[model samples]
Target: MIALPPELLGQLGTGLWHVFAVFLRVSAVVTLLPAFGERSIPVRVKLAVAVAFTLIVLPAVPSPQSNPGLLPLARLVGTEVLIGMVLGIGLRLFVLALQTAGSIAAQSTSLSQLLGGAAADPAPALGMFLTLAGLALAVLMGLHIRVAEFLIHSYAMFPMGQTLSAPDLSQWGVRQIAHSFGLAFALATPFVIASLIYNLALGVINRAMPQLMVAFVGAPAITFAGLFLLFAGAPLILSIWADALFSFTLNPLDSGR
Candidate 1:
């Protein structure tokens, strides 16, 4: 057995602890974020991923001084975890855009009540479609690579043991929440316009035939029409969504910008 010197042993211990801190932060983010972080994924799987990612990122993270005390170590770990959660939640906000758009589209088409397969949370059929589409688009657009780059850059932006002001974090969080809605509206714009036109025509038809069961008759027509519109406009919508996601993931500060 090769016995290491006390100094080398101390350095190795510090490095390992730092890596653990990074893992905790990343794991917290993935636990709550969208897609891979969804509740549907097993806890064990997430833990495994976090460990894997931490190993990958350890070489990139700067080394910290050896400290055996629990308080300092706890604080350092907390900061890393907070930063990780913030980044993860920021990416999650982009996914919310698609869900919001889907909800609006569903309501417009009178398909809001339709049961969709469980995704994230139990959502409507339209929401499910939108979520899947957004996820697939993000993956296709190299989200994983961009996310890794972002994680590496984050250490530079917010270094270990630095205090992050609560006010600033709150402001950033609020902006992300607002941006989620804005992105959703942008994605659903085409469907919104289509719904308006369809509703207008329905209104006129009802006026012309007062005895007609407009609700029952128009439901099927609107559902079919909405499906058709979704099919036709999906490509454009997905492209735009992917671009927005890429931009968001690359620039965390862009939520406010």
Candidate 2:
């Protein structure tokens, strides 16, 4: 049997440890990242993606020597997971923004409660359509590559084996939650306005013709209008969302700053 040099073996061990740390963080983040982390994807495929990304980011990530005891190592791994979750949860907010926008749009147009929550979330058919379309669009635009780059750059903001601040993380989380809801309401504003006008028109028409069966006429009109609005505004909506996602990917800390 041939024996390897101690130096080479030590180097290999260090490299493997760094790779493992990267894998922990990558896997955690990938489990929640947007298109890659969607319910439609298989766990094996996601794990494969995490491995691929770990390989790419290994060179850029710094490996600090630490106490290799079991308890200490476990704590480091847990910290990595927490960092990954914070980064991932930031992007996840954008997905929720889309969901909220869809819900509002569906409700305003009376298109709610029609599909009975076909998707994972309790969203209307319109919401489901918009979300699926948005996700597909994001994937087509090379979301994985953007995410990999984001991970590589994240080291600057969140270093490995570093202690995280609870107050800072909490503040960031609150800001992200507020922004998500704001974006959602902004995206759905147009639909809400149209619905308002639509309802007002229906009220006047019904007042003029009490027994004319306004439900029959108003329902179809709002439905058709909702579909048209979706068709027309979807591109703009997705464009805005993609811009925000891409921007955040490149500079994850800018939102907080």
Candidate 3:
């Protein structure tokens, strides 16, 4: 083998270190990413995706420190993992929001038991459908491209080897959770309104015609209304959800918004 120059070897080592550092964060994020990190996906596939993201993000980010001592290296590992987890969980929460909205809608319409276990997450069929559609829509709308930009931007928000402030992180986490629930409620508002109207009408009919079994008569009406609303309103609900998800990916660190 031809001998390599000392400078060339040193540069190679530095490059490898940078790649490794980036990989740590990328792998952590991929482990909890929305559709790409679903439990149903094979582990090998996830690894390939993480590696691909690392390569895409590497050039855009500032190079990490090379040749760190053992203690500093350990700290770097922990810091990167923590940041990646925070970011990944932020994206995952949007998926959870969609699930929550679907559950609420199903429960309101008395359709909660309709194939509830069909999905891997043990959610109602409605929830599973919404999640699958939302994920597919997100992917079709260039989710991968947005994710790459998000990953590169993250390096600026949480620099290499820097630890996050606990109090700030906690507050941010609270805000994100609140926002997620708020979004879910917003998406399920139509179902709730329909349920309320149905209940009121059922009560009036029962009082007006006590001889008639209002429950039997009202069930079909509510079911039909629920299905129709889903068919008509799904597009709007998904559009709202997609906007929120994209907004979050664009500025994950700004949880206050």
Q: Which candidate comes out best when scored by TM-score? A: 3
> Which candidate gets the maximum lDDT versus the true structure?
3
Error of 1 at 20 (Å): 1.5
TM-score of each: 0.91, 0.93, 0.97
lDDT of 1 by residue, 131-180 (tens): 88778777776766776677777778788667789999999999888878
Q: Candidate 2: count the clashes.
A: 0
Q: How much lDDT does each candidate structure score?
A: 0.78, 0.86, 0.92
Ranking by TM-score: 3, 2, 1
- Write model 3 residue lDDT over 136-172, tens digit each, in one string: 9999999999999999999888888899999999999
Q: Candidate 3: misplaced stretches above 4 Å? A: none
Superposed by TM-score, candidate 3 places the C-alpha of residue 16 at a distance from the truth, in angstroms, of 0.8
Q: Can you tell me which runs of candidate 1 are displaced by over 4 Å? A: 1-3, 117-120
For 24-140, candidate 2 gives per-residue lDDT tens digits of 889889989998898889999998888998999889988867339988788888899999998899999888889889999999988888895677767788778777788888889
lDDT of 1: 0.78
Which 10 successive residues of model 1 have the least lDDT summed? 115-124
Instruction: Give the winner by TM-score: 2 or 3.
Output: 3
